[model samples]
Target: MSAGETVHLTLDEVRALAKAGLAKTGLSPDHVDAVAETMVSGERDGCASHGIYRLLVAASSVKSGVVVPDAVPELSEPSPALVRVDGKGGFAQLPFRLGAPLLAEKARKFGIAAMGLNNVVHFAALWPEVEELTRQGLVALAVTPSHAWVAPAGGTKPVFGTNPIAFGWPRSSGEPFIFDFATSAVARGEIELHRRAGKPVPDDWGYNADGHATTVAEEVLSGAMRTFGGHKGSALAAMVELLGGPLIGDMTSLQSIEADGGRGGSPIGGEFIIAIDPAGFVGDLLAEYMKHAEVMFETITGQGARLPSQRRYEARKKSLVQGVEIPAALMRDIEKLLEES
Candidate 1:
């Protein structure tokens, strides 16, 4: 198929493609499964940026020897309200898996808890992290820093990562309420996608190395990406950098990129995840409060205001029945990676 053509794939096909490609990249069997599941979920939820396309970036880290293929994630309880995991140079998924249960337990016992995942290569979307906690009837928040590619407000220097934050609130029934977004004007992958498609990005997306506004994606990549909402977004990005980096005893965006040694791979650093139990706060009134929450949601939807995760949930339903479609160019690329490796 040509680069412009598209390939339709079932959820199973997406999983198979992700697993096969990741396996060829020297990620261990378990890690491949963990990461592939993320890709499948991304595709199933219509997040093209986080789907099978993510293999290119993940493989870059593995191929460069930045990610230790066989690293084992080790977990420890740092405090009654905090858990920590050392990823030992592997992907973030396994570390999170190892720590999630402990996080939930601590949250249940202490009302709130935090988990720090360190020395991990972060690639997947944060919603999955928070969504998992919400599934256990807990509110969750997650944040992580990417490489130092974005500039703070009104500044030319690339001092901030395209830091993303996600929050999840459990509902009485069906899907939870969730929102995940990058502080950058657009995700780095979005810019990369524009570059690969030979398309110009929006003027506000980035600036040249000299900091002049430009519509060219490649220049923005080598130069400075803009943050959304100017100062407000910059501040949030800084918060993510701080909370996910120094707060967790890991590298900041600048430090993360420096550690990259010029490898165009995923960031190597930490993630901050918080879980809070509503039961702890409301007690037996949990049911009443949950109904109250539903009223708020209904009021919003009743006025035609959509919840942030509505589109994703809708796509998920459709994909479960109809599957997903991927660009043929990306498909061929993955196929080649699997073949050559």
Candidate 2:
């Protein structure tokens, strides 16, 4: 296939590609499974940045020696409504998988609960964690920091990570209402993809080392990224930094990047997740409150306004039946990692 051509792959094929690539890196079977599932879901739902493309990044992390391929997460409960897990320097997926059940249970018992995951190397989006809690019939919010890449609003230096926040709300029927977005103008991965494709970025997405805005992807990669919505986005990014960092007794984005020591692996830090159970608050009037939420959703969609994650859900349905398409060039990159094994 031509470099720019697309290749269609079923979800199973996507899983196999992820698993094979990760397994060759000496990651344990369980970690491989968890990571592969996250990648497959990203591809199935049309998130190319987080999909099979991540295999190359994961493989590089293994080579960096910063990640423990077989590290097992350890869990503890310091309070009735709080759960904590230490990832032991492993990827975040397995830790979240191990702690999610207890988190949901605590939320159901106490009306609300919080989970803190520390020392985990984060790479994927936060949506998977919150979405898992929503499947257990709770409202969930999750946030995490990454390596410092984006600059604070109106600043020239890099301080904040992409600092994504994800939220999930359970509904009586159909898919949960979910949103996951970076506080920055765009995800760092998107810029990296542009660089790989030999393309320049939008004028506002990144700035050079001297704080001058530029369209060159390489400059942004070396310099800093701009936050979305100017100062408003900066404030939200600060909230994410505090919530996912000091509040959890873990490293902030700056600290996380410093700890990396320029190894260029995933960010080592904490993620804070909160889950709320409506039944605990409404008791017998759960249906009444749910009706109110449905009306809100209806009002928004009725006006032809698309809800958050609507396009993703629609893409998911189509991919399930028709499979998904990825760039031929990215396919070759994934194949190369497996070949190197």
Q: Candidate 1 on 135-159: residue-level lDDT in tens?
A: 9989999999989999999797798
What shift in Å separates residue 279 of candidate 2 from its native position after superposition?
1.4
- Model 1 residue runs over 4 Å out of place are 1-4
lDDT of each: 0.92, 0.90
What candidate 2 gets wrong by more than 4 Å, as runs, is 1-3, 197-199
Error of 2 at 257 (Å): 1.3
Report the lDDT tens digits of candidate 2 across residue range 1-341.
13478999999999998999999999999999999999998898888878888888888888898889999999999788999999999999999999999998899888999999999988898887778888889999998888788898879789899999899999988888999999999988789888888898998998888889999998998899989999999988888899889998899899998999988878999999999997987899999999899999999999999989898899899999999999998888877777883
Using lDDT as the measure, the top candidate is 1
Residue 84 in model 1: lDDT:
99
